[model samples]
Target chain A: MTSRRQLLKSAVLGGGAGVVAATALGSLGPEAAFGAAAPDVEPGAPDPDFAEGRIRSIKDNTLLVLGSNMVFHNIRVVDGTSLWKLGPTTFDQAKPGDGLYARGVRMPDGVLAAESVWLNIVNIKGHVSNITSEKIHLDHKGQEVLCHRVAGKSIAVYSDAPPSADLSLLRVGQHVQILGAWRPDTNEVDIATVFSPH
Target chain B: MARSQPTDPPIDLQAAVRGEVSWFCCGTAWGPCSSTGKGACGTCNSGNLQHAWPNTSDACWAITRPDSCGFALSRRTCGFQHRITALCSGTSVVTSIADCGPQTDLFCGERSCCGATCATDRIIDLTPAAYSRIASLSTGLRPCEISTP
Candidate 1:
């Protein structure tokens, strides 16, 4: 298991300016806005195919997964979400080989150092409250929150929650319902049927 | 035979959580919705609402109902690699992720403010001038590395 303290220490000591965060768990502030100051163009656009992989190993907060393309990926799942069934509070209960999808800085070291990694989750929902580079920060039930997306981004299943409801019609103030798996460490929330009022 | 609340269903909360049931999704692995913040985006400041965040290393916990800290789910979006570095001294302006050859330490030019302009591993920090170049972006060249007290 990776201690948050070790992860923090290594972020500064292990190398120069190289931060390998597992998901969005860093006290570090925002990365100077790429487009905030300068005009931006879509360079390697955020591919919906943010790669899917299986957990190959766990090093501290780092998770090395075997990407579908045969590439080994090191990731960090943010420990938070908008769904309840996904999980909460810890990463110990998670299993490797489960699918994952995420985006962040990729290191030449073949480690896909993540800002956030989504796990296989679903049928959970919530409202967005704020935005920052550090986290897709949320306010679930008044507690500081984080989101760990699961099993790629498209929330795609249902057995409980509202079956006839689609997760698309949701707005910030609008109420929502969700379902899926969750892990507490990477605070990433995965949704399968984000429901909302039309 | 026991009766249930009119507003609440007669299902076991625990069973519903553990049961393999329906699941909506955000699409992309780490679904980025109105999805992010430094530390303030939940149900901590609203009224008439039940906030929902993902479950962490353990079980899913709910937020206070009627807190106001979340935004609309659809109106949030960004596609840049926001990063953190320790190489700032008096010079380098650092930006998103830079790959250091398989575990080798590295740096991106002094605040390569834009991700497109940066050459991965192009700028480094080990000398005085290097620090000055970086510090120039936010603050004038740092005289020397300050140690945290």
Candidate 2:
């Protein structure tokens, strides 16, 4: 008999872009709206179904993670998993020492069967202290964060408008929220999306 | 209920105050957070619907200093309830003051918007439990509007 996991794997692999779109964009869609139930977790504590840490080792399809609490975790990636680094990506792009957040079901053996993985992602609020031709400097919680613009990959959302490739509206001293991929071990990040109010 | 003290000033505004919203971990242990202890008020928990206000106390005011960014914020102590709405997700949560933080002065003139609704600066920080009620935990920051309930 075909198991649920095997069925999902086949569907995800064969479905291509349509499946990828739903998994990528609707990954965080409101669970309540769909009547989907969330795994119960204690208030204020780290969620058991989610793991946040740096990858220590990658052995084939499994990732050994060293969590922020100094605990260790094993994350298993299947074909159905949606892997996102700077953007929608494949499993091969994953590397050692990269920070990540994995959401999935915890198997009885304690291995996490990851459904989604976001690597080196950092969401930050800051003021644009300065802007050059390619870099935007931000002051985040008194710390200076260097943000590099990836030409084709970078986009901006102004005043709740649709995203555009144009970043000309950004000005010095305007408060903004940046969704970007961290450079790992550095204060720099690669800008993905910049949200600003005009 | 947290009653205003004799020395506490009245907040007389009718419009909702808008600003940037973020989340922090507190109490117990979790992922990269480890433990934030009990926070400034000594009562914060990650699982509770609590938040941090910039102008909680004189020392907190000195650190956050919303005024440095041209915004005047009222001093609300711990346990005071405030309704926070996340502009990005169009969700709202009622949480009480649990600590002090997000140093508004650091990113003084930051602005964010969703459609015609917009907000400026960092004014509130909610616990993991409270923040997740409105926006995804992966989305670390959002534009929001705050009001006294």
Candidate 3:
């Protein structure tokens, strides 16, 4: 019989590779959803340098990247060591409008524990949000949804359908229908629609 | 009891947010909900067995006892599942939306839950006694989307 540890190790190794392959394949669906007639690059492009998208959510140290159109990308950015800053240090300064990138291992649960976060310069639109140093929170229909971004900053929307953007624009007293994946592993919602006034 | 092949009924699901969480109207607040689609007909027990179906034109469910209802899945799962219990004609039974586990799946697979999918579109997890208490007056409405969450 396979030893417990050996079995676990094997599962991880297989699962790790499977995750990479799954993300690679999963992104393809969005590429297709966005009407990408054809994508030449391999799954997720394996771009070590950078992966940018709106702030879907931050759980632990993972960021779920909603690529162009509806493509989903899980970015992990966490460093266990004390020396490393580990993931995005400026969680409070991160906002749905701000573009973000991180580097981490992709877990089987469709989340990424990043080692670092890169805030890209972009235009995103959102309502006024009370900011703090730890984390920002927004009121969606009396629901205090958490947010990330610098306090007292300009708001802009890069994509109307961006789950992050839609989540930010939600009215405190209005109803917002949500249809997407909440990858608890990464602590993010791969939002598809925020159900705005069509 | 024996009933002819019936139809699935539709259910209404209410959405609410408590403090910071958003979820559907559940439990006693909302009526019965299950894949069988029909409300509980109060026919499940030691002798009066129920027949249900977890999947149909109804809401999703998670199997709590697959063995009792009868299933053959290799691994146990919990997300959305459904089941139906058949009783006397015009009195088919349905299960409510409930968190199912490995043991539940075992029961479901055996045929303890709803034997076949009901015509109702919602789910009800009420027991036979509870169902008999309120099922007489509660006829489910047609299935419709929440339009808004």
Put the candidates in DockQ order, highest first: 2, 1, 3
Instruction: Give fnat (model 2).
Output: 0.08
**Which stretches of candidate 3 lie above 4 Å from their native place?**
A1-145, A149-169, A177-198, B1-80, B83-96, B99-149
How well is each residue in A73-153 modelled by candidate 2, as lDDT tens digits? 998776557677768788899999888777665666788766667788766667899999899999876778899999898
Give the worst 10-residue stretch by lDDT in candidate 1 chain B: B99-108
Candidate 1 lDDT by residue in tens digits, A1-198: 654333433453355332454224432222221111211212212222133455767767667776544666666543321111243224554466555544443344544433333355322334556433322334544543454333434242221222342333333453333434444245555443332223
Please give each candidate's TM-score.
0.29, 0.65, 0.21
Which residue pairs in candidate 2 have backbone atoms (N, alpha carbon, C) closer than 3 angstroms, thus clashing? A43-B47, A44-B46, A44-B47, A160-B115, A175-B109, A175-B110, A175-B111
Kindly indicate the candidate among 1 and 2 with the higher lDDT. Answer: 2
Model 1 lDDT tens row, B1-149: 22211243322221211110111222123222113221122211100011112211111112211011111111111211221122322121222111111100111111221212211211111111111112221121111211111
What's the best-to-worst order under lDDT? 2, 1, 3
Docking class of 2: incorrect
**Which is the leading candidate under lDDT?**
2
The candidate that achieves the highest DockQ relative to the unseen native structure:
2
Of all native A–B interface contacts, model 1 reproduces a fraction of 0.03
Error of 3 at B6 (Å): 18
> What lDDT, from 0 to 1, does candidate 3 have?
0.27
Q: How much is B80 displaced in model 3, in angstroms?
A: 9.9
lDDT of 3 by residue, B1-149 (tens): 22121232212112310000011211121111111122222222210112222332112124222223332222212222222222212222222222211122211211111234222112223222212211211111111111111
